[model samples]
Target: MTSQASLSVTAETQENTLTEVFSLQKSAFQITPYPSLTERKHTLQLLHRLLVNHQQNIIDAINNDFGLRSSDESRIAEIIPSLQAIHYTLKRLPRWMKPKRRHVSWQLQPASCKILYQPLGVAGIMVPWNYPLFLAVSPLVAALSAGNRAMVKMSEYTPHTAELFKQLITDNFPEDLISVITGNADIAIQFSQLPFDHLLFTGSTQTGKKVMQAAANNLTPVTLELGGKSPTIIAPDYPINEAAKRICFGKSLNAGQTCVAPDYILLPENQLNLFIDAFTAHFQQMYPDFAHNSSYSHIINDRQFQRLQQGLVDAQQKGAKIINVSDFAPDATTRRFPIHLVTHTNESMLICQEEIFGPILPLITYSTIEQAISFVNQQPRPLALYLFSHEQDLHDKVLVNTHSGGVCLNETLLHVAVDDLPFGGVGPSGMGHYHGQEGFQTFSQAKSILKKGRINSTQFIYPPYKNKAINWLYKLLLR
Candidate 1:
């Protein structure tokens, strides 16, 4: 067979496999549409044990994919969070599964209303390359906790991690219960076209739009966790050293590849030099020699590295001054790009226009607080917004004036770790939420049900409305 014919046959086989697995999951869900609370807890426990048993393997697989993913970073960001989510869900699963009593209106006095959190049958999760394990496991926790079967699509960029994860899941869980799909973009497109009861995707805004369009054909509801230029504002009253330390930690973690990492900073123009010095000092303290530092993570792959390099080149050509606080030279072979603080940037520059998912932070100075707020408001809504301020009024002002998926006051990125908080995006950043209680709801349907006992108060107006009693009832209801 020719090369093209061989490739076509392989694609056809993969598509058939996806369809078969989806059909199996759908049929399995039909058999046990509502899994018992004990069953759900057992599922979560199995997942927790899987992560615990293969902690080292997970770390090594991610490192192999990234060329130099930090072991500690993987443990801290991926394994720990996955375990915490499971534990949290296990503790609250019983309550979430119980029927919730709802108040009935006066007109419906004979009826009792309640909401049943029913499983969505099957959930489709699309994991991004940046945080492959965490992104995949987090949504899977929600799906299982809500008593739904799930199929996760892992990114091709992290092939090693994806394959390892798929192998691990296959060994521990039944294929029809929880399956992981691995392939390139073509496979991802096919996966998105599946008629899942609910779909949750985490990636870029452009890709999210396409996923949503594909899901629309099946009329599937989606919860998109897309990324945007999340901004940080440092108030004059806040301590510059404290603000710098927190922001640096957030940006340096995962080498600033986080969806909620502070993309840019807004500070008083006069304090720019002071803030820069403090930020530099703190960053150096975090990663003393970044090029050889094992704690510092490299960009995921060549494509991401090249994209970030091009953004830097475009910024410099457009009159932006790029300052490397650590002064570490980037090694393309290793793909270890240092944190760059960009200044004198304009809207035309790619650094200002795009989501800087790497370790590059742009400093946009403003004379007044209003100017800082206005600048953030003018841009597309972000996934996360950070404000460094001690004043209550200032915090309230920014919180009320701005729009984002989540807000961090006097800190950054830690909000996502809170097990009870919902994490997601808004506007161009993305849509819907999935974490803690909100996550359970997103994956389950809040089915409303009204019950009527032998006593039926609604009978008074059930027949033809020609009598005085019916007229009296209508007047009472309208009143």
Candidate 2:
């Protein structure tokens, strides 16, 4: 067959798979519109146990996909958090499921009002390649916690992990309750086009627009967790050494392959050397040898490695000073690239223009706090903002002056791990939220209900012409 014919065949198969699975989930949801709290808890329990039982398999699969994904990173960043999300949902679901009562006005004295949280039937989740397991399972926990059936579309970039997840989910879940679909961009397009009640996607900003556009065709509500150049602000008063330590920790995880990772830094103009020295020192202390260190993860694949390499080249050709934090040279065999911090970079370079989804950190200096705040505000709002400061005045100023999906004071990347925090983005960064109680609400609909008993109060004003008593009652109520 010709290449065109092959493409057509592939498209048709994906269409069929998406339709069949979505219909199955919708039918199942119809059968149990509002799942009992106990049923939801049981589902969460099974998921938690599945991770606990097959933890090693999950770690190995991710490592195989990444070529050198840290086993401890997988267990810490993926498995442990996934387990905690399930447990947190299980503990809070009872209260989340309860109908919230509202006070009814005296005019409607005989009626009772409340908001009943109802599942939005089937939910569609689009998982990203970075931290595949956590992104996939975190939203699943929310969907299940709110009593909805789910269909997840796993990224093709992580084929090994995707296949392993497919098998594990198939073994534990009924097809109608939850299903996993895997494919390239074409398959992801079809998955997004499906008529799900709600769609949640975690990926890049450019692709996020396409997903949102596709979802609009079906009028499906969506939650987008997209990436941007998240900025880190280091105040002059805060200890520069401590700030560098935290920033290095955040950026080194998965080689800065995280959505909420610090993409760049805004340092006080006088303290640039201090930050650079402290940052390099902290990174070296953390990983003594970069060339052979198993603790540091390699770039996910050749394409990503090339992207980072090209980005660094562009920064250098534009006259930006690139500082390699390690003594080891690039290793083609391992695909491990050393973390490079760029100074004197401008907006013309690709590193400054786009989200650096790798281990490249750009340092921009600011003379005043207002200038720092303005720099962050001028760009697309980020998924997270990191401010290293101890003063309440600076904290209040930054909080009120700028906007981001979430904020962390004197820390980095830990905000997302907090079970009580709502994780998401604002403006170009992304939209909607998940995690915590907000996640539960995202997958469920709050349906307002007003119940009235047999009462003749409304009959008093039903006449064609208002009488004296009716007029008096109306006046009294209006007063």
Candidate 3:
């Protein structure tokens, strides 16, 4: 057989397998749709143990996928957060499982209204290549906590991590309970087309649209955790040195391959040069000799590395000054693209036009705070917005006027670490939230139910609307 035909046959076989697994999970969910709180907690415990036991393996897999993924970064950004999420969910699962008592109107006396959080059968999670483990496990934690079976689709770009994760899951869990899917883009398309009860996807906005479209055919509700040009603003009052240090840490972590990483900076015009100098010093201190530093991370692959390099070139050709903060050259073999600050960027530049998912930060200066806010408003809503300021009025103004998935005042990227705060985006950035309680609720269906005794008070108005008692009651109620 020809190579193309063989590949086609393989995809067809995988699709058939996926369909069989989906049916098995669906049938299993029907048998035990709502798992008890203890059962859910036990499942979470198993996941927690798996992550803790295989920490080194997980880190090594991610490192192999990326040319050089920092071990500490993987633990800090992926393993630690996943473990924390599971821990937090386990502690709160009992309370979240309780049916919420809702208010019943006076006219409906002797009746109780409550919302039951029921599992939504099968949930589909599409994991992104960057931060593969956390993105996959975080949502799975929520899904299992809500008592739902899940089928996760791991990114093909991170083949090593995907294969290891699939193996670990297959060894530990039942196929009908939690199965991991690994394949190329064709498999991803087939995976998304599955008739899931609820689907959650995390990736670029463009790909998010495709996922949503496929889910729509099944009438499936979707929670899209998409990426956009997340912006950071350094206020005039905040210390430039401190702001630079925090921004450096956020952007340099994972080599700026984060969905919530600060994409560009909006600073006061007069402080641009000072901020640039401070950012350079802080970044250098954070990762000295970053090109050869094992502490630093590399781009996930050459495609992403080349895209970032070309973005810098395009910015320079369009009259933007490219400032290499680390003063290190790009290493093609290692795929380590040094951090470059693009100044005097215009709308025509690729750096300004798209989400730079690499170590490329574009700096846009404004004359006043209002101008800064305006500039942000002009762009589509982002997944995250950061402002470094001590002024209460400034914080309130930015919060009131701007729209973003989440905001971190005087900080960057740390908000996601908080277990209580719900994380999601608005408009173009993405839709729906999945974090603490919000996550459980997103995966579960809120079934509204009303309970009453044998007494049928509603019968009074059921028939013969012309009755005097009914008229009086209507008048009284209306008044």
Question: What lDDT does the true structure give each of the candidates?
Answer: 0.93, 0.93, 0.93
Q: After superposition, how far is residue 283 of candidate 2 from its true place, in Å?
A: 0.6
**Taking the tens digit of each residue's C-alpha lDDT, what string does model 1 give over 341-365?**
9899999999898999999999999
Total clashes in model 2, counting residue pairs 3 or more apart in sequence or in different chains? 0
CA RMSD (A), model 1: 1.0
Please identify which of the two predictions, 2 or 3, would achieve the higher TM-score against the true structure.
3
- Candidate 3: 10-residue stretch with minimal lDDT: 286-295
Error of 2 at 130 (Å): 0.4
Candidate 3's residue-wise lDDT over 1-479, tens digit each? 69989988898999999999999999999999889888888889999998999999999999999989999999999999999999999899889999999999978877999999999999999999999999999999989999999999999999999999999999999999999999999999999999999999999999999999999999999999997999999989999889999999999999999999999999988888998999999889888877689878999998998899899889899999989987789889989877888899999998888999889999999989999999999999999999999999999999999999999998889999898999899998899999899999999999999999988888878776889879989789887
Cα lDDT tens digits for candidate 2, 234-310: 98889999999999999999999999999999999999999899999998999887777888998988989988889
Instruction: Judging by lDDT, tell me the better candidate of 1 and 2.
Output: 1
Worst 10 residues of 2 by lDDT: 456-465
Candidate 3: give the clashing pairs.
none
Q: Which regions of candidate 2 are displaced past 4 Å? A: 461-465, 473-479
Error of 1 at 291 (Å): 2.5
